[model samples]
Target: MSCEKVLALLNDWLDDELDASQRGQVRGHLDNCVSCAQSERSLRNVKLLVQAKADRGEPSDGLRNRVVDRLTHERAQGPTSLRWTRSPWLRAAAVLLVLASGFVIYSVVISGKLPSIAHATVAEESLARHIGTGVEGPVEPRWPFETIEDAQRVLERELGTATKLPIRSEQLKFKGASPTTYGSARGVRLFCEYKGRPFSIFALESIPDEVRQRSQCCFCRRKDDRYLVACWAARDLYFSMVGTDLTEGEFMAQLMAR
Candidate 1:
């Protein structure tokens, strides 16, 4: 496919809305074409950014009160007294201000809701996320699956491309996997149970800088209560291994060897 065709198909291509043949053509073009590949990555990042914005939490009490106060003041002034409404520039600026306020409110709420993630500590976030995520009902989201291979195929469509999965091995005994986010990039989260203990592996696009060992091959561990979160970076991906009842460095030792 030519650059123009690939660029036109980029949205559907990243959204995985294209058919098999079209997807192959786009993928092939991206592999050989540097500009197109960068464009594809940029589009993917933009999608993730939009998804992050869409998942914003509700407005906080203080921000909500302030917004209400502003609206009340404007209402008390009446339309005729609000002279800014007469100028297009001022009207646009007013709209932008309200939108900016909404953005701040959403940011505050999300940070309050997921404090660990807001802090961006890989091990800490891993521990928090491990405690939070798992299958909730008889049937889970994205159609659910029992293996990473099945999950990879399913999530490739969700993420809109061919992809690879993390933390795959016979020893882990995959129980389930789902689509997740790693900062501003796409991620995959998988669950496993071995020897009757629960574990979670979060696969990320890049290794976050918060890890203490991030300076050297990017590996670190955080132990909280019964959970042990070991984060590391390897070729083309980053992973966080969260499990319970493991020693301080047990998971790290094993993961480092691999």
Candidate 2:
């Protein structure tokens, strides 16, 4: 197929709206045509972040408070002075966590393992990247850019494809973007603000199937009331977010809620 034909069908291709033959042709073209592939990936990324809806659901009555009481605290802050020092997820390493519509489940190693980037869960690594900024705290311009479009162009060059990650996903304001490594996968880490609160998002070409599958089933650090680690798979991209102080509902709304 010509680049023009492939471009016209890009959205349909992403939606899986094309028939078998058409899909194959588009896929084949994208596989061989660097320019077309970049357009496809960049458009897909745009839709994933901009058009996506949130599903954070509310926690049961008294659940939030009870969990908070059990969890201990530490002194720390984000690059923006957001107070997330509470080490709720940090307290216990192995815990059963859940979230979303009916029931969302989290896999193992929920504690402070800080596993190597190659093996760490998106949540774990996100947390480390978050707090790991060391004494200086979270700094600005980790990957400097003025607009989301600028970041997109840079990501295109870095990943060998075009990308336009949103400057704002819903209420989250784009803060910064940095190259990141998670499980042999390379992606960008975005610093953002939700209603003035700080958080980090890991947007990668792809994540491990196990991680994505587990996220579909659900994942969370239930006891750590002060902080939230969540992941979701959307189209060709995977996102892992590390934030603090949002209610169970807020967290769920970000991912698996119905």
Best by lDDT: 1
Model 2, 1-258: lDDT tens digits are: 999999999999999999999999999999999999999989999878766765557689999866754342211222212222222221111111111100111111344332222222334544334333422223232222334456544433422322222222344456666666555444556666755767665554445543543332123443545556655443334455566567544543442221
Tell me the lDDT of model 2 at 57: 70
Instruction: Name model 2 segments beyond 4 Å from true.
Output: 1-171, 209-219, 234-236, 245-258
Report, for every candidate in turn, its global Cα lDDT versus the true structure: 0.51, 0.48
lDDT, model 1, position 141: 28
TM-score, structure 2 vs. true: 0.33
- Deviation (Å) of 59 in candidate 2: 23
Q: Which candidate is the best by TM-score?
A: 2
Off by over 4 Å in 1: 1-147, 150-171, 208-213, 216-223, 234-236, 245-258
Q: Model 1: per-residue lDDT, tens digit, 14-78? A: 88899999999999999999999999899999999898887777777699778875565444334
